[model samples]
Target: MSTTEQLELDPAEVQAFAGRAVADAATWMATTMTMFGDRLGLWRALADSRPVTSPELAARTGTDERYLREWLAAMTAHGYLTHDPGAGTYLLPPAHVPVLATESPAHIGGLHQALYGLTGMLDRVLAVFRTGGGVPINAYPRDWFEGLERFSAGWFDHLLPQVWLPTLPELEAALRRGADVADIGCGRGRALIRLAERYPAGRYTGFDVHPESIAAAEAAARAAGVADRVRFECLDVSGGLPGDYDVITTFDVVHDAADPRGILAAIHAALRPDGRYLCLDINSSHRLEDNRGPVAAYFYGVSVLYCMTTSLAHGGAGLGTCGFPEHTARELCTAAGFGTVRRVEMENPFNILYEITH
Candidate 1:
């Protein structure tokens, strides 16, 4: 037999094997969710002081060490736990608990539960796609909102105030000089409302297509006592961004758009001469190498599956082609008549800080 023919395997069989493996791996992610016991503080109890054996941890935390040991083994394999055979102890580090403990804003234990729901959503994706109908971004029930609010309010809120805020010094400076600012596709307008509160002199507008979200945003602005300076509009940015603003900001919005370029152009038009355009979104595709580490990759997959791609399919403009890199963003800005474009690091992890000049 020819060398090529001899070395070739059955493509169908190979593909079938790989397909099942992938499915099983995804299922494993959901299965891991069932063991939320460790996430809920069981591991923390074990690692609290000197490393304790599983039986002692179980007694301390009022759990069954037998099953707890199994959980520990799983977590150990996942690197969330360190097993010391010499001491017969299991430990979870502080780094692992920051995202697990409910008290912290970065607590991602709730999101881990959300991932289980996304798995179910994945099961329904094909049917929804076939019908060409989409589940709303608000499809999840009220409890999901409660969970998300806990996750988002803490994570995103902290991120914006610390990271994204500093990146806006130039825009803030322009706005202090009396420039209108619009945060297009602002969901709930948390960031926009905050900016409005800070820059009392600047007009702040938030645009989003979901009426429900817009209402919530307006209410939030009112509650924040910036209703006078802040306004919420229910509109699709794909239609076009309104112009004459000194600064326009889009946070985590571009990657979820079906037509990013249209919005980019619209934002360009909306800017005053020499205005600044700020974009903040996940640094996917562009910085995949820098971001492809395990934890980041996992969330990126979740965003693409449940957030980005689903947003487009759900009767909304989809994030097209996972968005452009920093250079690509700069090029797009230049193409849109922006004279200069720069990227900076925002407080948000793996977030792109775009500074474009018109």
Candidate 2:
């Protein structure tokens, strides 16, 4: 055989490749179905419930039986639900309730919704790939912001006060004593509001470049009866922060900034001499080889579709999602005039918390 003919793919290898491709397609479809279930309250209805026929689940959720039947089949086939062939019913197992129910911290339904929204930006993202720029934050679908709010709620609600704050004893003490605090890139202002509610004496300010997010944060503060203590402003800290604060926080914010160093510098300047700086960002490796796994894949995907693109739109350095790992974080903090950078001993799958001091 000629050299070119000999290089042809073996039948077994071709079959394996095809099988992998099919499996990936199935996984994609499963994710779509997961989002559908989340949006329609199907998962919520199934949680903690006994095995039921599709018609029964449909009736409970006020959805069409035909659609429910297909959805249930898809969920079962994808192992999201357990199928009882003998009883002709389906159920979300007790073990899976935490992963499906919104009330549970382990629920991942928000991520499914967020991914669905991110996929909608593919057309614009494709243009950026061909051209040399990216889509702006405002150009994305409104659902993207809404989905992000949902996806991040669990962290702020469950982890912030209970798990994360206790890890920083000094910061926690200051918060209780009514320290002036500021949260940069405070999307929707939930974190500040939560803090304000817990530490009623503490005054809080939140800043975000997005006006809509600022407005939403304001509304949330009002609704939570913390507006007097927690106020949000639409400001780009890349220029500089206006007020000195006892504590400043940036939650998954730096990587998306047009000028991360400038933001860090601003934070350094805005903090009091003995103030604390809390940074909650993605946990990944500075080296690409060490950043393998599903989490890394998710971060990279989001970086391309959202984080990196938003920065590029602002003519930024575009650090991307996994840009600031522990090493880079320490380096940036040091350059920004912070004297110390300590990684807090808080274990979280999606984020790493840092306590920085000058």
For model 2, the run of ten residues with the poorest summed lDDT: 101-110
Model 1 per-residue lDDT tens digits across residues 169-227: 87667766766889887777787777766668888888986677788888888888999
What RMSD, rounded to one decimal, does every model reach?
Answer: 5.8, 1.9
Per-candidate Cα lDDT values, in order, are: 0.68, 0.90
In candidate 2, how many clashes are counted?
0
Q: For residues 282-337, write the lDDT of model 2, one tens digit per residue.
A: 99889999889778988998999999999998899899999999999999999999
Worst 10 residues of 1 by lDDT: 140-149
Q: List ranges where model 2 is wrong by over 4 Å.
A: 1-17
TM-score of model 2 vs. true structure: 0.95
Best by lDDT: 2
